[model samples]
Target: MVSSERLADIGYKTFSGTMTLYGGYLCSLRVYRYFHHREQLRIAAENQTEDIIKD
Candidate 1:
């Protein structure tokens, strides 16, 4: 008799690995954008506050 393999086992080796790699890449990009946006806002707010203080 021949043995049959399940799809889940095959998927664990292939699809799951790819998904994890892509997810990590996407997460890093999101974090980078979040920090970049926050920094930009901070700089803008500081500049505005400085101008107001000067006046």
Candidate 2:
């Protein structure tokens, strides 16, 4: 798992306004962010499902 500081470092390094939008580092960051978002959504859905089951 990537630490928050490491993600910050990646964001800082990639979006320093000196690099192109198509850089590999930026792409990886986007993908990582996407998956992280998805994971959060999945966890929330599971919690909601559990609550419904309990009720």
Candidate 3:
């Protein structure tokens, strides 16, 4: 049978590992959103320039 102390230690490690994974997932999502927003801005700027040049 596992000692109470050992059980507590295992629980702590599991919780820490889960949080680490969650943090990484959040960071990846943020990075994806940032790049997506940047690309949209670039496209808009290009379109604006084309409009200005034609006018």
Using TM-score, give the best candidate's number: 3
**What digit string (tens of lDDT, one per residue) describes model 3 on residues 1-55?**
9999999999999999999999999999999999999999999999999999999
Q: Which numbered prediction scores highest in lDDT against the true structure?
A: 3
Kindly list the per-residue Cα lDDT of model 2 for residues 1-55, writing each as its tens digit.
Answer: 9999999999998787456655767899999999999999999999999999999
Whole-model alpha-carbon lDDT for candidate 2: 0.90
lDDT of 1 by residue, 1-55 (tens): 3334666677668988999999999999999999999999999999999999999
Q: Would you list the C-alpha lDDT of every candidate in the order shown?
A: 0.91, 0.90, 1.00
Candidate 3 worst ten-residue window by lDDT: 1-10
TM-score of 1: 0.72
Better of 1 and 2 by TM-score: 1
**lDDT of predicted model 1:** 0.91
- Residue 9 deviation, candidate 2, in Å? 30
Better of 2 and 3 by lDDT: 3
lDDT of 3 at 25: 100
